[model samples]
Target: MSEQMIEIQTKLYLYDLANLAKEHGFKADDNWEFSMANNAERISIQKNYFPTNVTKIVPEILLQVLNSVRTALKQSLAVKDAPDAQSIIADELNYLVAFNPKRPRT
Candidate 1:
């Protein structure tokens, strides 16, 4: 995919995730950052507030967020618009889920 497409997809994914997080009772900050290294892009989702102690976000919420984004992406792709970029975003979301900090180790 082109750099422009990738950036657009990333923004879409972040927007979806942020909305999902807010719907799940989490505070999603508007301040998000992105960086590229080793030919890969990384996004940092910011939280409005931080807990003093270690907090483990439940995996269920993460799964819900992932599903929500996946569904939206599928719907967007159904219109035959930016299929490649949407697919990449979906794959990236899956990767996030697989390595989610909230998920239990198997």
Candidate 2:
């Protein structure tokens, strides 16, 4: 039996959408459409095309990911005030500091 194909959609913020376009080398006239709602823009992805084709550059993408992490951590810490979360965040920060991609390799 032949498998059926399904379509799906997802959304991203303008900043992230720009990065995605840049990473994919999409031209200015590329076929894309967007809509604005709740003070954010949204796009309809036809399928799971992004994950198969895109890879995240650390410098370009890490800041956004870290911002989200810190925001969530802030909210969680406010609600729970857990020492473990504080320690985990500290350790992660230190690890990021120690991770120098430009350092000479032995």
Candidate 3:
């Protein structure tokens, strides 16, 4: 179920499709019906296939995650400020510095 065989079959079908289309005096564009059909069928065949109940514990720091996202949304809505990654880091740094006990206000 690791998709090694599926990947090979996919390659075979690709070549088959190409050859068939060529025989009909037309080549397939990526945006062509054949392409779209293949793409659509792939979603049905392969998309939902996953392994069994391998219970992997994902440690989510939920409070931190939620607070970060909430703050980002608040800033975006209040000031139309879409937070970039660097700006978010800077904001976190600024927060730490402002609240730090060691840093005396001069």
Between candidates 1 and 3, the one scoring higher on TM-score is 1
TM-scores for every candidate against the unseen true structure:
0.30, 0.24, 0.27
For 1-106, candidate 3 gives per-residue lDDT tens digits of 2344434433444454345445544423321111011224334322332110111111122123323333432322232443444554433321110011222234
What is candidate 3's local distance difference test score? 0.28
Clashes found in each candidate (C-alpha, N, C closer than 3 A): 0, 0, 0
Top candidate by lDDT: 1
Better of 1 and 3 by lDDT: 1
Model 1 per-residue lDDT at 97: 23
Best by TM-score: 1
Off by over 4 Å in 1: 27-106
Provide the lowest-lDDT 10-residue window in model 1: 33-42
lDDT of 1 by residue, 16-90 (tens): 556655554543333322111111222222122221111122222333333344554443213333224344445
lDDT of each: 0.33, 0.28, 0.28
